[model samples]
Target: MFNDGSHGFSAQVSTSGFNRRRFLGGGAAAAAAAVVGPALLAACGSNAAPGSAPAAAPADDGAPATGILRVSNWPLYIADGFVAEFQKASGLTVDYREDYNDDEEWFSKTREPLSRHQSIGCDLVIPSETIAARLHRLGWLNDIRESRWPNKKNLQPGLLNANIDPGRKFTAPYMSGMVGIAYNRAATGRDITKIDDLWDPAFKGKVSMLSDVQDSLGMVMLSQGNSPETPTSETVQKAADVVREQQEAGQIRRFTGNDYASDLAAGNIAVAQAYSGDIVQLQKDNPDLEFIIPESGGTLTMQSMVIPYTAENQKAAEAWIDYVYDRPNYAKLVVFTRYIPVLTDMTDDLNKLDPSAAANPLINPPQSTLDRVKQWPALSDEQTKEFASTYAAITGG
Candidate 1:
């Protein structure tokens, strides 16, 4: 079930053994006990194989109301149990489906189809930078022009200038974060604060990666000196060496999906390679679980929503994309999903919704700290395959 890197670094993807049928059958009242914990259940939804989702339901009523807007995303991407409200406001029933567990799945389904400017069968989709750029190149995007969504101007400054969709022109930032450490301070009996910390011998068998190649190894490259902005294949190769060596030394305990939240909350791991937003929700119950942007440098990353060429409900899709940026609503999502708000106004909102933002370096990192972070370059198809293989070899997946 795992890809052993006999030839080169590879990725091993499999089921997490969490019961999805039981969760769905349990319904809302039993929702709190659904899976892992709030940190994960609220952040990651259940997974299924990649395939076409059912035809979107018709908008209610005889007259043509808003059409069903099919949106594909990682599990629990939208606010939990708020579909009814979204349907009411827009008159569009969201045929929301969770077919993708990670960006790689998104790329597999959307990259080629979108590159050819063909329909990928979703109205709204979220993708990491590499695929977002490819979508822009293929002209698969319908413009989220400033005239249409003025609130975009308020997105956080760091994301405002990302290279993948520079100026945020092609894709509106859905949620952006760095791949770094989420540690159990109480269990580790140490303050974890750097990318280099993942390699510490004392923490051997207590670490898990993102179950991704880029973010996993890209963070290592950032620590060694490289990013999408200054992509040096040589540096990347060296970074791969770090993973290979670390794995050989038994530093990595497992390669995990969002499931790490359960392990960290249960004190099964002292530290984990984590996304920024997920940790915010994790801290709600386990207040001591903290995230850090390693001093050795970490990747600056963003996920975005793009209106695809095949959208069935373009207007509804555009409306929903803009809704993700509304100050009050977005603040609520930040609390539920643990993603940092792109709007500057969110700082005050975070103070009110989750005051830890004032002291949480991961969400409100100082200007100087953000300056040190690097991002991975959008790869060409040949390069993506090569780099993916390089990363696979390192981790032995």
Candidate 2:
């Protein structure tokens, strides 16, 4: 799955030839089945409420630097040559492992050790925002702000103080993807601009939505002028009701994972809820395919880089984060991952690297699109179970 080159190394990491953004978006159904019930609740057993002040981070030991940093991140998320470049620049050896395939699996593996205030053998890990929030609440993550990370100022203005990591005390965004609409223009014979277009009678039985509860239902809620960032039981139920109506009337063809890309490319379906990164790759093969963040709105999900509380190489980990935040280095990462860069200033540097990627709206989204996409709220375990159960009923899981 990996190709080694003279200058650097690249990996065809995923079996489906996509990255973790697509993997999580497509496998969301199975993830929900595996993580949304008792396992999730057990992991979120902290008494602190969401948005409350997180418990004080563990005190930093004055131990000498280990000079070795270990990171566990999702597969194929970084640029080729980055490891070697960082090592050369900082004189640190990085033991980078792409083993963070699933959030729940990682959480399950580390819970026992972390709950005992022990190391899980890695200095840093990257997990989706929700999981990072859970780790913060559990006090399992170190406060990155305490590290010597000057480039933290380069973060996009909107990401500065997210609800999950207010002031980014615990985590920083690594990469992100938007959940939006993708359509085959040859099949639709027109443009698809809004979420409501998917429900139009003209495209009945030729429309497919993602099996991911937050993504599919969030779009429906956006169509009705509701924001998923502040979802309530009433709004969630309303969205679920619309989904049920569409399914029963045959207005919706099916609920899908990553397989929707194949169907859409082959003209088996006209429209599908898709991740932005997936569309970037799909459009290379099918010129007729187009992706858009709906005029009404869409959802944006992010994976974050965090330091474990028990890390032995906190200084080295901080240096690594700072190294990637440099504009030129971050541009290379954006090009390699084909995901949204978390920096406010990237287009110029990205254009210098790859002009084509700099122009792709999916990769370098304009301000208008950025204003319209919202991140889903950090739902409590009970809230998650309720929403997932309702969505399962509609999707007939």
Candidate 3:
């Protein structure tokens, strides 16, 4: 789930691997996923009214017995004892697998089964918003029945009823972050503010963009006064052209995954397209590294949870969603992962766990920063292929 188009777990985690101590100590970016376009997930939780108290699960009303609850998510993305807590509370065998590493890869494994309405082995799976959107469109996911998710009331307003899964009937956010710019202050010798700063001659060949289209081209789109939120092939092509010009002119050093972090920290690159969570973690090692949501705007993204159509443990799956959404439970995640929690009021609680993590602007950006962020729009399969090809070509992948 944390795997963006350009980076994988190896790139996102520390060199020491998924060591809990090092992870909590601030490892790689560890963000859940990338951006979605305008209203991409706008109505995802459409069934639930924002701020409404959660309702009891069907188990309370004598729902059928459930078997083991199988959940697949990104490695090390959640808190240490998250699975244990859920198991203890629900008294259900929880089979949690952190094998979901890439959107495209996971989709390939489950697509055929899901398309045929067959079980995909896991009861619940977390995928990036784009994958979730595609699954919902194919009728492969289950709706998150609100009556069993009383904690739904706490989801930040912006994430509720997202357009991708309106009424959140088919999906719910697992974790979210922003796409922006990260720069080496020492390398640039100046503060960077807007997207245009990336194109400055002083930083030529010292700047990098993401290899993913939703990130690199999306930001480029914003800088060019185009909206990725409602992208057509034409709009996306235009954005791709902008990046091509830079690549051809040798303005950009290279398109990268999270490996760009090492270069930026080492002053190998002065400016790079980056993610909010990654910058926050990177700053623990180098205070000189700064992340900015360009004044023109940035992109907001999330990795989401969805149940397979053939899932046999719907109650347990929904129960897990409710459990995580509970303020205190969610706060544990905020402290451990250092990613922005969708439940907005947990800052006070998070402060107790890690003061620095609680106050970091990159982890908890202000409303002003959020206001300038956009999501990637939904793309048809043909459009997605076209966009992917364009991005690959420009990056020389």
lDDT scores in order = 0.62, 0.77, 0.71
Off by over 4 Å in 3: 1-67
Q: In model 2, which runs have C-alpha deviations exceeding 4 angstroms?
A: 1-19, 22-66
**Per-candidate clash tally:** 13, 0, 32
Best-fitting candidate, scored by TM-score: 2
User: How would you encode candidate 3's per-residue C-alpha lDDT over 16-113 as one tens digit per residue?
Assistant: 12222211201112211212311232333233222223322233464633568999887777787889988888888899998876665566566555
Roughly what TM-score does model 1 have, to 2 decimal places? 0.70
Q: RMSD of each candidate? A: 11.8, 3.8, 8.0
Tell me the lDDT of model 2 at 276. Answer: 82
List the lowest-lDDT window of 10 residues for candidate 3. 23-32
Candidate 3 deviates by what RMSD? 8.0
lDDT of 1 by residue, 218-332 (tens): 6777676566466656876887787777778888887765568778877878889876656655565678888887777666666678877667676677667766777766776
Instruction: Give the CA lDDT, 0 to 100, for residue 373 in model 1.
Output: 65
Best by lDDT: 2
Query: In candidate 2, what are the lDDT values of residues 290-393, reduced to their tens digit?
Result: 99988888988888889888887777777788888888989998888778888986889999999988999999999788888888756666666678778888
